[model samples]
Target: MTTPNQVFEHHELLYVNSNNQPVYEDAMPGVPGIDVQPLFLDPHNGVWVLKVWFHPGVILPRHFHTGAVHMFTISGHWEYVEYPNDPQTDGCYLYEPGGSIHQFMTPETNTKPTETLMVVHGANINFDDDGNYVGILDASEIMVMLDNLIQERGLEPANYITPPQPDHNTKVRNLK
Candidate 1:
């Protein structure tokens, strides 16, 4: 009669408090004034959850997702080139299907920066105007990039920012 939620006293739950996560400034290269906080990252599975902050007037290059992407806007406003009819403002939720191509930007009219929580399942492939391949970005690639940046700055990489290590000691608990 043990359920997935049942755990022994020695087991620690997989929980990450929003306040406990460290925020990194200028996380995306070539994109100044953008901040990122890793909410969850599974390098092995190529999935990730991140809290991204976009300064007003920031515009990202056109890109397409290999897998679906879910985003929840916490503050400010933003829009996509492809989804011009649906702009995501504060308290808005957006789900972009795989292979959807668009340019993301925080409207210049926005007085405040935009903050969003995003769960991405696959790589974001950048493309040129002529549809030429440029680059790919995924959870694994982002982790490696961040790690390298930390190393170059002489700062220790926070391993916990990545996926939580599997606990081998977990055992099914039966409460009858």
Candidate 2:
């Protein structure tokens, strides 16, 4: 069973965009200060929901996430970067995707502001070895690419792919 209601459980059909009015607005990328928006894509439990917004030395550059990415900071203090070959330290610390590194950061100040509301079940993204498809980060090399993407994907019952707090909120009010 794929789980999300057993892989969407057939199709009696509900409603995709029946005036939900948003196929995708800020589909995440204009860059200036960083704001990702892809409100929903459930299509019967495939799962897509995203809403990340950052501003404050924004460096969500070194990308990664083809699938299974989940996060939730929702208010300030989300530096969360990685990549410590250790050069006097300072990359990022609380990113928490299997322990850190699927690249996304925001925290400038509206009182130390940064927000992350995520649920990514896509897959096959591993950008940034400086090949430069789109790895243009500054803040400590985006924390060594967020500590090399959480030490190249760490997991051992330690929130395997960042799963510690669920149900902080869930309101998904009909997204298109």
Candidate 3:
């Protein structure tokens, strides 16, 4: 992010919001936070790699990405909707993508808490092109569901605290 043309390095550590609360939960006494850190922002490629952390029993509201959403579960018990290509074929997966619209939930796993690393490209940037909305080809079709997803966007957190831990680089999911 130094310069638009400068080479991006992986060493620079960026800690995104890990502890965030919904507007409605502000008055609550106890509440966990969801934080995200953008590790890489390559202007040259218009790409972003972010590390997302959710406290135990954290449930994320339903939402769709403006751009391609890529994710890899580092550890813990991560769960999501039924992806078209479910690895287990049991209709359960943490890495949900391909514009699948569904409410997602992350629960306490016997393993370490789940840490997801994701790459979302061209999310809010159209610096080049005619500011074209490349998130989806036809906004008309997807726009219909946008309202519902936006309504479910603000989800209150359950009162709880999960200590932050080193971002152990676990294997990322292979999304073709």
**Per-candidate TM-score against the hidden true structure:** 0.81, 0.25, 0.40
lDDT of 3 by residue, 37-123 (tens): 434444434455655565566654444444566666665445554442332212223443445544345555423345667665443
lDDT of 1 by residue, 48-165 (tens): 8888999988888789899999999999999987777888988999998998889998887888789999999998999766888878889888887778778777764443446555
Candidates sorted by TM-score, best first:
1, 3, 2
Which is the leading candidate under TM-score? 1
Worst 10 residues of 3 by lDDT: 21-30
lDDT of 2 at 13: 41
Task: Estimate the lDDT of model 3.
Answer: 0.42
**Model with the higher TM-score, candidate 1 or 2:** 1
**For model 1, which pairs clash?**
none
Q: Write candidate 2's Cα lDDT for 118-149 as tens digits.
A: 66554324465573575332222322433444
Give the lDDT of residue 60 in candidate 1.
81
lDDT, candidate 2, residue 83?
39
